[model samples]
Target: MNHYDSIVIGAGHNGLVCATYLAQGGQRVLVLEAADTPGGLAAGREFHPGFHASVAHSVNHFSAKVASDLNLAAHGFEAGADGHSIVGLGTDGAHVVAGAGALHNASDKDTAAYDEYSALLGRFAKALEPSWFRTMPRIGSLAVGDLMTFARMGLKLRLLGKKDLQEFMRVASLPARDIMDEYFEDETLKAALSWDGLIGSRMAPRSPNSAVLAMLYRMSGQAASVKELVNSLSGAATASGAEIRTGAPVKRVVINGDENGLGVGGVELASGEQITADRVISGADPQTTFLNLVGVEHFDIGFTNRIRRLRCNGLVAKLHLALDGLPEFEGLDRPGGRMIIAPSMDAIEFAFDDAKYGQCSSDPVMEVTVPSLDDDTLAPAGQHVLSAHVMYVPYELKGGWTDAARDGIRERAIDTIARYAPGIRDRILHSEFLTPADLERDYRVTGGHWHHTEFAMDQLLMMRPTYGAAQYSTPIPGLYLCSAGSHPGGDMVGAAGHNAAQEILR
Candidate 1:
């Protein structure tokens, strides 16, 4: 018999953000979650007794900002010990942690040449970041907002007066592979940086507009992994006097419609109980929200068409492990930072083509991190958490996620690592391979897309999900979209939820 100001469906990090803000603004908010955890993709879980794993997301880009804003630290928010991923690839498997692009060719006889070459891309990121990270717009269609942002960037470059503008345009418009070719002679250096262009997408290094994907996805300030960001988000939500129920997958949302047509009424749950609210915000997928929860008949054709067209594809797989000791790469026991198991751009491209054709690569590119090497708490005493981020595995891969093939892909990816980390096989204690299917089934990622929708320029901003409807406000008033699918393109900052809550308050 209790009522509230808002009911937020889905306790994913973003949904929690929206709920916290609403509640902080004096609105009583209740967050409904289908999963048993608060962080949709950002939450951590105990993989085994005395061990936890980040199943969905592992880093927090700009998580510190969110934590500070919401006072998450005061609410028992714990910091993960390590900060960087140690990376390298190929026969040598040379390694460096942060800014690995410069160190990929660390041992190259052509060291001076490689340093100068990577410096160019570093400068490019410096120039490109401001344009891509502008404050989000107030209201507009997603396409128009992107164009406006793009044009504003163009004007800013134009003011640079011709020569600077020419270089800016070249860096902005050049294919990442093309840019890589212009700089590094070594294939591994090229492969490593080019992989950044394909993070969380279905694009290859040589793909056009892939460079922009590199620029857009990398815009987060402090968050490096999904785990860190969700930690901040979950912390913030709890601080606002809100309750989060993980593993409480809501079976259905009951609607109380007024015969007089006062724009529908409060919602009910699958338990056949009524929970009234002045507003109900859906933070799950558009398909789950409109069709599954609201019922398809409630919306007209245009709205349904737009919702149906929203792209939700999963193109990556994350595999985690606990090791008895450190994996030993050749001359890489101290493999400074992040490891990139890509030998050449062609190898990355081949994996890309395999995924596009609906098959996982027998030899896929892997980014590996052994966090316990830096932090003691992540594993049992003298043990480590081996995290591998394997990309470009299609949602509908050939041979499916049969335990055998999935294990084979796991072996291949690890074998690819063995080429770099020679004795890694000996340190193995336990392994957990999560294919795209596991991600979708566990995180409700629709098609295993870490992002609810593709981040193609067309699907950004207000055009996100639908034209003129991307800024949180839906066709039905009171409903809002605070997921990464909304705006700023899901780089693990709860910006969408944070932004949406601000709008709701206004």
Candidate 2:
């Protein structure tokens, strides 16, 4: 048996981040990963010959504090200049570009309101920034630190002024559809913005607090591509004295009792090797960590049920196409940037309706980006890689995900893109599509959920994963969860991992 001060399960970005912090604190740590590489969904992989794409396409809004703390930029991470914009495609070969330009079919009134809406959301997001990085305070426990956190949160709201404070609360709970309808008249703009809120979520555009989520998503840091990011974090971890082992899958968390209930001893690998450690922090999802890895026999029924109902089913499918050349979209001003394919709010709602019943949407909404346009290293000379997020893909397909069903989805996505960019099919050299089930198989993410859990009000803040383990501490001693399923609920931010390390150090 190998022994260490701490063993972190899963060497995903968060796991790496957690290990980096712990090792920086002088604790001997090891990160065990199931895959050949780290970064989990955020890591870039070769989907087709000579073309690379991140498992999850978007560069999550990373925290500057985390970046500074981990010295990411010092390790060679860089983001593209700040001119990226989203183009919303219409059926009739027309498009609306959301940048510093006029909106197609949008009135001046709608334009002014859009500005106000963005500024208001920006203020609200700024107010919420403090909470996003720190641990969520316990509901009933009033420790001095917890009370100070609450006071700071309340002060942030108070600083918004009485009128803005009242309005912020109202907007925070309002559905994206309702908020968009109230602020903008153009369906194109509304749909483009609302799609951000719906990504990775099982919720439709009409779900409450989705507007707030969209703002948060909008405010996220657009960092370097996943490959660079993973390399940077991996470098940081190793430099901080953390040992990372890839191709190592943990079979289960080892637990033992010594007159004080159950406590994690370490982890047992699937290869039957046992590594002993004083503490174990799981970077895997909550359900997988608890029920699957730890086993339900150790947990009480109520906690088991809580883990069982975590709502982590992924509703998004990642699509990557290796194109012979750069594809063209009619009426799109720029040659390369992000594109939104949801024509209207109702269209997005209809797509959600299909997924609601376990059927793939006939016209799914997507966010398409050609990374090769910005980072030429992702593809060969003159060639390109198109990455897209096809949404409303229920984890449980009505008839299950069949070859025919997957083909249908692939074709539907290509066909939809062809509507905006004629001859796009001819440009494709090869294509790769990963359904939620595929994500599960490849990433070991239960239900293929990118966030490890859905970002819902019911599963957020103190109630995240569960109130019992909200602060990263599990019911079992010496065990902790550092996955996205913990506080702050996903989307590439490593706060959960960083915060978890802080807790473990304490």
- Best by lDDT, which number? 2
My TM-score estimates for the predictions, one after another, are: 0.85, 0.96
Question: Which stretches of candidate 2 lie above 4 Å from their native place?
Answer: 99-107, 217-222
**What tens digits encode model 2's per-residue C-alpha lDDT throughout 337-387?**
568999999999999999999998889888898888877989999999999
Q: Check candidate 2 and list the clashing pairs.
A: 61-220, 61-221
Candidate 1 lDDT over 1-506, as tens digits, reads: 47777888888777977888887888888887877667776666566555556754345344455556676666555544443443545574454333534353354544666677545444555554453334345443366755686678656556666765576566665677887787656777667766666767767777776455455346344534454456556766766776675545555555544543334345666666677777778788767777777776666788888778877777878777777776676866465455778778888888888888888887788777665565467688877777778987778777567888788778887777777776778876667777777888887767767667776656764467666457676666666667777765565566677777877887
Q: How far is candidate 2 from the true structure (C-alpha RMSD, Å)?
A: 1.9
Residue 131 lDDT in candidate 1: 38
Model 2, position 107: C-alpha lDDT score:
72
Model 1 has an lDDT value of 0.67
